[model samples]
Target chain A: MIEGAVWRKWVFFYIPLAAFVFLLLFPFYWMIITAVRPDAELYRPWNAPNYAPFWTANPTLEHIRYLLEETLFSTWMLNTMIIALVSTLISLVCGVFAGYALARLNFPFAGGLGTGIFVTYLVPQTLLFIPLSDIVRNFRLGDTPWALILTYPTFLIPFCTWLMMGYFKAIPKELEECARIDGASRFKAMLYIILPIAVPGILSAGIFAFTLSWNEFIYALVFLSSPEQKTVPVGVTSELIRGDVFFWGPLMAGALLGSIPVALVYSFFVEHYVAGLTGSVKG
Target chain B: MAQVVIRNLNKKFDEVHAVKDVNLDIRDKEFMVFVGPSGCGKTTTLRMIAGLESVTSGQILIGERVVNDLPPMDRDIAMVFQNYALYPHMSVYDNMAFGLKMRKFDREEIRRRVHEAADILGIRDYLHRKPRQLSGGQRQRVALGRAIVRHPQVFLFDEPLSNLDAKLRVQMRVELKKLHERLGTTAVYVTHDQVEAMTLGDRVVVMRDGVVQQVGEPLELYNRPANLFVAGFLGSPAMNFSRVRVAAANGGLRIENEGLRLAVPPPLAGRVGRYVGRELTFGIRPEDLRIATEADPRDLSFEAVVEVVERLGSETLLDLSVGADTMVAAVEPDAPARVRGRLRLAVNPERMHFFDPATETAV
Candidate 1:
């Protein structure tokens, strides 16, 4: 608590908190306002006397309608959704098994293998997309949803594996041992006992993988071609802007709609996500 | 018929030899306890019996079959960890029923066994609660219920009650003893608390480092400790030791140091005959010493100056300086003792212990 004076509390606590909140939310607020603003008002000069940039007297649904009907925005939505869900499922299944093996099994070079997986996650996507695009071409997966669905796990699996490994390590080893002694085989013990306790860790990993693939740009832009095969991020940018002209209203509308599903996913699992990250086991 | 026999059991963790060659025959339905300090191999031995730790070179016989190569699941045993190891995600009923469920018991039988075990542990009211929702003592009971519901051949407990508070530990200790008596299952319990070992075990095994020092009934080990380490480790305010040279006097042997002279008791005279004129250790318990009265024999009495007085309601402890050595005496609480005062203390001849200083073994 800021002590002694009311003004001190305002200066040290309230003002800084307010500034951070404003800085974080201002872009979303601008997106919402611009999505509803008229084109005439959006294109007006900054020094124009009658310019009212922050608010619109007549809010419109024209941009949303145009985004839905005039372009392949709906197709991109379906494409991104299918790609993100399938890759997240594939990555999660691989990560759960790999993480469990790394955390519990005592094979030789286990520590080195874990470090190698982490190193793969650390490789920048900008450079990795070069070789990955070649693989995509060789597999004859270009201009298709299968291209992004199969390639996204290259990065997502490593990421999910490391996250799940740390979470699995936090659980007590005795839980599995006790289960084994209770007459369950080693595999059954892990499936029934260890995996149930690891629900939060699995959920957090799934959410993170889903968001990463949903918002990915470099690989999605490179491997996928044709307007119909694009995802939200690439589709919004490439289609909304014409040569030397930006469709400010419709572009903001696309941005607003594009972020809603990811936002909803985060808000729904926020409690479990925090618990998973902190790695607290009650017993 | 569940007799656990360990023959030449040993364990080595890379460069560290954790449990040396050990052999034990735990009788059917016996509550056997292993007591020692940290890293003393007590827990390691219990884990070996539980099949959680692989033996280096040994044979373990559960009933009749050798279990050295068997995995824990096939060993027909249940273990309770120090932290309870209760499944946090499961309800108390599910936690108790889990082992039986894994063995593919029918639904009605699983429910009946879980309820029966919960009823025995007095946890029936908590049947639907999750493990995290219960208190520490309740979690401990749930862990016990989990083990008992399985009705395994052997039950292994690794310091199960050490996590509870003092009062709860005592209460749970009594409940555990009662539970053992009712179930009549062979149990191998590991603990560092000597009080728990004495109060719970039908026979106790005392270990140090990685070696088994002594295994006998509680008072038997207390009265006749195999060596100096067992003597000191088994008692509270432990047994006192004073180094003295054995001297020949009056056609018999006497052990004497700077401030005192004491004759070797009749039974131990022959044992001390060869150690005459050589230094040895004299051992006595604090409860064996008392303020000497006129009826006490002069040959068994010595002088000590009181340094501190501690009144513990039931007894008074006097920290005394006897010549160059310090000792503590537990006397009646009403004994009028004060600091800087001199008192004549009489030793019980039969209770005096003599040990060879070099070997630290009983003479």
Candidate 2:
């Protein structure tokens, strides 16, 4: 009886937790189910049972095979990875230095500069897409990943810099002073002391920049005209829609595959991601 | 080890002079302390000597070299800050080895010095543990160890013990004195605590309002303060002061106040004669005022109403008021005294201090 009460206590606490867990897992579960279901079962009414019993039914790999063979899904995935990785690297390099400067150095108009950079982040990408599209068209870089790479950094750099600046500011100035007094040059101090301590924050900001580049749809949709040059979001949406009819199986399959890598990256750096978000918001 | 000399050191923040015309000479292998209240520029003066703050005008010399234009690292001074300033990310070993590594010392040499400092600080076992895992006292030891490993020409302490609890502060104070004795390195310490100044320093310099008030051996400053500020700032329970007028009586000097009058010692008669009939302030320490007994004459006595009696174990502090003036008297804990009762207290004439009111200068 006593053991049951103790078990009940745990169950009481975990019930809502389990419900939230189920709530989060439900959409992914449904997507996997819909992707594997035959076309006959997929069109059934809402009240009908659309899922096959896992033990009795034989699962098929047709959707995965079709996604690979019928469309430029692999090419789109490769292009997205390259664009995201390059953009993240660029943002990290620019953000770290700008963050360090905003956090530590005092220059003429430094406060104004910090506020100006943060305000640039506040301007929505939706508002600037028209003007940026004109610039990309003027440069004749349309239908190329180079356009996305160049345009994405404009959004990534400001927000990433703002995140890293807040993170760097939380570090004690005395630590750097101690390094300086210990015979380190200013550059060496930043490399040895500040950078090591700021790793988590930097990683968090990098993940954010990578995810933003990967998930961006509107700009990718409007800018890239060639099917082969399209990123994951644009390629999936444009190729999956034929004419008022959706190819639910392969589309959902590609979407699920496309989001997995990013989800895994986020899960790996969840602690730092949360810290970065709160840190940037607080600042 | 090297002597640190500050000549006409002045620092200005806008129109406010934080440290003004402050000239200080700290000898090699000597432990000197700067003692003052807040905003008195003791810490500012120390920072200027460390090259952490710029001297608006004047020169700082470590040994024979002018360090006014030098950075802190080139100045060869290690400072133990009040907050310990240990690297939160680094373990104790790394914190101590950081300075040596930055100087491009050999790896083996760095390891030897870090271990030696850790052993001296009794933090060897905890070298791999981060700072947050250590207690306050342990962290303080790590800070001291970091400075000790550098073996710099001068060690500067900016009220290093101020952050510790009272009990740990006393313990650290004794350990610091022992460390100073063992090393015999030139050290400049800053503190607002007079007791810390008296106990730790070979020579104490008291400052006020960005000016050097008095500089001398602790006992010299205690026994013979330079002025009213020094007298009031040095002692606990503080010295009592009352305005009085000096008048000549039978070839001697009589110090008269509203409640009482007493004869000045003959040696001070000449000094008092110049200020005769002029209003002056008389100062006396709490310990110097004793209860009148058969051993002391009644002529130097005054009546005081005892407002409160604090019965500390070894000694008693009596709070007494005479007319509009209040004074504290320290006596044997067993002394017979009751609150709300009148007591006769005798002032030792030879121990009394007289100051010129207008200049606040000793007379």
Candidate 3:
């Protein structure tokens, strides 16, 4: 009787996890099926006799070839890489110093400053876009990748700084003090001691910053006016919807290709990424 | 080896005075331990000397140079924290060599010093392991090795062994004393443990409420505490104090308590003469009280019911009540005593201490 009850408990525990796995993977499976199906089978009725099987023989690579060959997909990918890399780099440099200062330094209004940084992050980017557009126009950087790199840090820095603050706080204060007494200057101690120890957190923050820049859409759509300077989100959107007509095949193909870089980057830093995200979410 | 001189040092945090107008001189190559209860500013004092904490006033001198304004990097000192504070990411070798590298020493010199320190700390074999990979004792040794490699003029240990188990703490206490003797470096260690201070320090500074109560050799502090605080703080089973009054009695000063009275020592009779009718705090160490049998004349005696008798293998501790006041007495483990028994105990009159009732100062 005890064995039967234990087996029932195990079954109850695994059922939801199994169901969630199937739900998560089903969409990806459908997307792949849609991407490879012949054009005639794209929208067949559910009750039709010609509905494709799981292992259909009519699979085609036409959409993938079309996305790669006819459009400026490669250029958009390159532009996205440049903007994300530059933004992530800038955010890390400014955010890490600000985070360390907020965590360790004592000043008249240090706590207020930390709270202010977090408040800045809470101000949605949608609300700042109008004022930011005028600033970008004034700087004469409207149609360049530099515009995105410069604008992204506004959102990225605050959140990154907040995340880094939590990471720094988790570290023992004694470690830094020991380093200081061991002939390390404040900067040297942070670099040699604090920074090395905070690598996982920093990497996690960097991955978040990179992914944010790569996947960002609203700002990129409103900011970039030229095709050559557009990021993946804006470029894909503009190309997929010319006038009122939709191009589902190439759109899905572009999206699949566009998301690959971010997916690869996340996988590379999955450990730090999880840690960093959890730290930020809790904050 | 260098002497540390802290003159009129004061540290204030906003409105609270963390350390107030402290003045102390630690001799060259002395193993000085600052011991106190929590929030007694022992750590604050040590940090101020290490240049990790800034002084609000006065000066600190290492050797002959005033180092009040110097940064920690320029002060030339090393500290071992209570938690060991080993860099979790670095190997033991790198942790030990870090200070040398930071000072821009030659790579060969750094390697040589690290290996030498590691050898002395018995961590030569664990040099490749990170801090988390080593046991608590090994990590503690690595922390000491890190300080040793720096070869600083002074070493500051901020409760370095407080995290160790009881047996390990005793072992490390002996090792630390031997290490100090071998290196002969000026070291300022901070701890709340009186046993650690007594066993390790050449001189112990007993502190309370951000002030130094007494500073003397371990035995001197134990035998002759400067104040009630020092006397109470130094002993393990702390000295018991009871309200007593001095009375004029036939050619000697009579110390009278609620249920006991004894003649004052000859040396203290004249000093305590002025307080003949005044109430004072009488202190007696637990170890000084013993079972009184027919073989000895009881100078000061008390008959009390044993409330609790703890047999600790080597020593037996008895908690007894006399006239509503409870006191603990330590006797031989094999002594024939049991709970609820009426026992006769003798307090040695010469070992008794008297303090001013209001001022709490030793009379």
Candidate 4:
């Protein structure tokens, strides 16, 4: 809130915030409106005597029904869910260990190695997919769920490892030392003390990995080919949109439905996510 | 219980020598305190004894067994950290039991030990609550309970009472001393406060710059300090020092400075006669000086102007200026003294200390 007159507050804070929120949310509103609006109203010309772009006079669930019945949207959802979960789990295990080692252990080249791993994440996926596709073919894993599930971790692990490394460093070193002196092996101390205190960090890392794998398109497109095995992002765009004709209602319908799971996850762990970002451990 | 022995202990971090060659034989069931300013390597030495920190060279022994190669888990020690380091997420009961659980104690024994430690700490009612829910004093009890439940051979404390308020610190300091007596564990405590060192330690080791300056009973260190640093470090307002030259005059050794002159007592005549014509640091605690009467010997008295008067209920501390030097004297609260008032103060010749100006070693 800007302190001063009401108009000053509006000019400095509230009005700009309103414009920003409207700009960010208009696309989502458009998606929902297009998904439920009747095709008759949706295709109405802009020059019509009565034209309203933001709202529809009549709304129906026909596009959702078409999305479920006519296409393999349900199968895409299932495939995406399995891939994202398995990849998140795989990344988390590897990330937690790598992050702990980089954060706690005294080893040669640890600093350089951490930076090197993060550098791999900076390489654009657009360029890496070409080589990755060749490997997927070499392993004969193309056109299967394994194609994306295993490939998703290539980017996810580095991202998760970096996030967890910073989180583990914020914790006081005395906690582990005290546990060790109390007759716990180093491994047991980490399991009982460090890992439990790091729940927020782990949860946030898991959520971020889930979202990244869920929205990932290039690797999904490059690897899977079968319609039923395809992920949500790929199947929705490639199968529904034919050569030159865009299925506006069903397209918007798929977009809106495809993003719900990520939103639900974010809201579910919103409190822990903020804690992880702030790295506040009260003692 | 076990005695800890460190021989030629040294620790080096990159280019910095954090702990130098040090040797200490901490007796079994003895409450030994290591007191020093920050970066004096007291905590580092304690950590080495606990095996949390690896020794760069030399050896550490718990009992007769050398623990130089053992990990912290095998060292049989428990530590209370400066911040308490309570496990923030667990209930007080679970935090206290974590050590027993890690050591594979039976469930019934773990509960019994936890309850006993909690009873001693007076935190039995708060055992089910989390550390964050408790107040600072309760949280401190939880930290202590966690350490006591282990029943290790030694207890290591690293400035554990420093985080508490002044009043709470004094209260906890007494509780800690009683706890040590009942537990009868050989404990190594570290603190920067001289008062804490004086009250709690059976024997205190004063360290400075990674080296031991003096180690003795608290009163011994106070009454008879080994060096300049120990003399000034162990007192409340600190021992005052003035550079003075020894002169052979009037058939006696006269200690003369910018402020005044006094004859060396016969007990130190042999030591004082050799330092004639050489400058030495003369030290006198504030409590050893008093407002002088006209009948007091002129040789032991000096005319001074009171600069500031600190009326501490039990005593009045007068900051005085003599010639070009400033000195502080603790006098009776009823003494008629005011700022800028000229007065004659008498020095206690028997209590005076002399140190070499170059080496700073007691003469």
Per-model C-alpha RMSD:
1.4, 3.7, 2.6, 1.5
**Candidate with more favorable, higher TM-score: 1 or 2:** 1
Candidate 1: regions farther than 4 A off: A1-4
- Write one digit per residue (lDDT tens) for candidate 3, span A226-262: 7878888889889878998767667777877888898
**Candidate 1 per-residue lDDT over residues A82-131, each given as its tens digit:** 99999999999999999999999988998999999999999999999999
Q: Could you give candidate 4's per-residue lDDT for residues A8-115 as a string of tens digits?
A: 988889889999999999999999999999888888899997788888878899999999999999999999999999999999999999999999998999999999
Across residues B1-363, which tens digit of lDDT does each residue of candidate 2 receive? Answer: 999998898999878999988888999999999999999999999888877778899999998999999988898989898878788778889999999998999999999999998888899999999988999999999999999999999999999999899999999999999999999889999999999999999999999989998889999999888899999999999999988888888877888876767788888788878989888888999998888886766557788899999999889999999767899999888999999998889997778888888988898
| lDDT by candidate, in order shown | 0.92, 0.88, 0.87, 0.92
Alpha-carbon runs more than 4 Å astray in model 2: A1-26, A46-60, A272-283
- Evaluate every candidate with DockQ and list the scores: 0.88, 0.36, 0.53, 0.85
- Scored by TM against the true chain B, the candidates give 0.98, 0.98, 0.97, 0.98
Rank ordering of all candidates by lDDT, starting from the highest:
1, 4, 2, 3
**Pairing residues by index, what is the TM-score of model 3?**
0.96
Q: Which candidate, 2 or 3, would have the higher TM-score against the true structure?
A: 3
lDDT for A141 in candidate 4 is 97
Give the worst 10-residue stretch by lDDT in candidate 4 chain A: A274-283
TM-score of every model versus the real structure? 0.98, 0.91, 0.96, 0.97
Cα deviation at B232, candidate 3, in Å, is: 1.0
